[model samples]
Target: MNSATPLLEVEGLRKSFAGVHAVDNMSFSVAHNTITGVIGPNGSGKSTTIDCISGFQRPNAGRIRLDGRDITRLTPQKIAKAGLIRTFQTVHIYEAMTLRENLLQAARPFQASGWVADFLRLPGMRREVDAAMVRADELVDMIGLRKYYDAPTRILSYGQKKLVALAAGLMPKPRLLVLDEPVAGVNPTRIREIEEVILNLHAAGESFIIVEHNVEFVMRLCERVIVFVGGSKMTEGDPKSVQQDARVLEAYLGIPA
Candidate 1:
């Protein structure tokens, strides 16, 4: 791939926790409008690398560039404002709120002033609330959760909750969406539905980096796969080629190639 313009680039990324290098000297570039899969065994630093890139965690050493702008030390909120967002493996939806309200809350803009202006129900606040509702509705439809929009999120199944969590992440309109085990614990029926929604979003001009332990499912959705082992990059290539690489298998299985 040409190096002139990449949507995202990481170089020499490293992170350590309790004397263990969770991520070590990893480097990769993601082209614009591409779906890249990140696969590795549990504790292989897959989530750590993503956290560093998305600003949930800072790397001990590395460079994170988006559209050629360095953002290594940016805060999570800053990263989101800059169009990078991530969804965790664990769900974060509000149990008491309806799916629509949850999405609406996520859609609201970041505001420093609190309580006083909101309590008064100012015109600007009302307008923002209305806009949030509209955006929430659109996202609900896109995620195929329109029927459950007004329902309490507590009543949704595990897979449905996962979908709603993903939709909530998109409410901020990120340029790159990083997902961590998006389909983990999901039922077989909803797995295909999730894939379809993700693919449709990709087709509509979104880039993604999916971190998953389920290699086969990721291979089906991603054009290229990057493998990590012992907190460093092992290999990366098209799914077919990467899967056939003896080194990749060794990395996943803890054996020599």
Candidate 2:
């Protein structure tokens, strides 16, 4: 792709369930190495948009492209392999596993070992396992979970589990990371930590598309914001401009601009 190409593009996207449109003619583009936020009221199709982009729900019409490659028909696993990773609003950690183990599992998709070799513990498999472990350790430290590295995920607080989920999404070093409600249910202190992690990652050349309800958090973190209302694009701009938009204010706060 050329330097001018967007990292991700959703054009004329539409999805409906049981004759009700969830995402209707939505279109947006996320630039490379930038953080973009999507926000709207409940039932406005925010989650549905994420689901379509991530390949969890196939769109009935429209196209999705990553790095200029059409991916609308791809499966979720294929899309992930093509360098888009996403996290859900709910934490998806394995409660029985240690923090380190959870990270290792996250890295498994990128590991080079075949199942047969892994079952036999061949030399190559051992090396792959070692590499995965090193990566897990690094991620543990990066997300401030080093203290809980050996502890079961079930023992961590809700906020800590969110951090773990974020770390897992980073394991593949995706070109675009889609975060859905990343700060939901997290404590104030953990929220700050999550913010720091996002900033640090973006500084390190990562791109993100965040779907969140915390307007203030979105304003503070995202370089661009997209507003959705009733399953379609309402307005989009930098944080200040979007916040100042009359339609956005009316939609979000029910106040006239």
Candidate 3:
């Protein structure tokens, strides 16, 4: 690894569910302004590793760092505020809310006031709400959802739902985005659209660590690839090199390389 610190780093991470080790001693780092792909078979600990990094699940052992600060034990919301955001394999949006409303909710700052702000409707609250809407619209346009900005999210198609998920992830203007299967089960037409959005986001100085099973998608989008097998690091490198590695072939059930 280089001497410069990576935007996000995982070291010696270990986690288990009911005695099965989902992620065992895993370690990797994502550098600034770079796309790193994480690929593994079903149950190869790809999602489990993301869970630990995003603070959704606590690891039994390991260290996680963001910009050299240890965030191993922080809450998910706190981690997000620190500029590390994660997306789910399944899009989670407010079905009853309009696309604008859902995006506005994401733009709101973490309220130190919490329920107090809601109860009292403190001064300047309305202004803050307005600002959030403005930001929300800008993001909605950027994610190509402007046409449905006022439409209820429940009425959107699966591909549109995925687009909303990407919009929501960008609400906070995160430094690092952890995408969990951004293109899964979608038709080929929509897959291209999602891929374009991801590339545009990357071009705009946002780093990403994407967990995907689509080998072609992963190979094309990632500058570097990390392969995991049986919950541990198998091999990692540039696209052509990593693809030809013997261990990588064995891990993914490919013919001997």
Highest TM-score, which number? 2
Flag regions of model 3 displaced more than 4 Å.
1-3, 110-123, 254-257
lDDT of 1 by residue, 1-257 (tens): 24477889999999999888999998998888889999988888888998899898889998999878888999988888778888888987898999988887776645333576689988777777777777787778877888888999999988889999899887877788899899998877788888888898899888889998878789999998998888988889999999899988887876787
Cα error of candidate 1 at position 138, Å: 2.4
- Per-residue lDDT, model 3, residue 227, is 94
Q: What is the TM-score of each candidate against the true structure?
A: 0.91, 0.96, 0.91
Output the number of the lDDT-best candidate.
2
lDDT (Cα atoms) of all candidates against the true structure: 0.86, 0.90, 0.86
By summed lDDT, which 10 consecutive residues of candidate 2 come out lowest?
131-140
Candidate 1 TM-score over all chains jointly: 0.91
For every model in order, what is the number of clashing pairs?
Answer: 0, 0, 0
Full-model lDDT, candidate 2? 0.90
- Write model 3 residue lDDT over 1-257, tens digit each, in one string: 24398888889999999999999999888788999999998899998888888899999999999989899989898899888889999988899999998887876754343567757887667667777777787777777788898999999998789888888888878888888998887778888877787888789887888888898999999999999998988888998998888888877975665
lDDT per residue for candidate 2 within 1-257, as digits (tens), equals 58799999899999999999988999989899999999999989999988888899999999999999999989999899899999998888899999888888888877788889888988988887788787777778888879899999999998899899999899878899999999998888888889988999999999999999989899999999999999999989999999889999999888976
> Cα deviation in Å at residue 164, candidate 2?
0.4
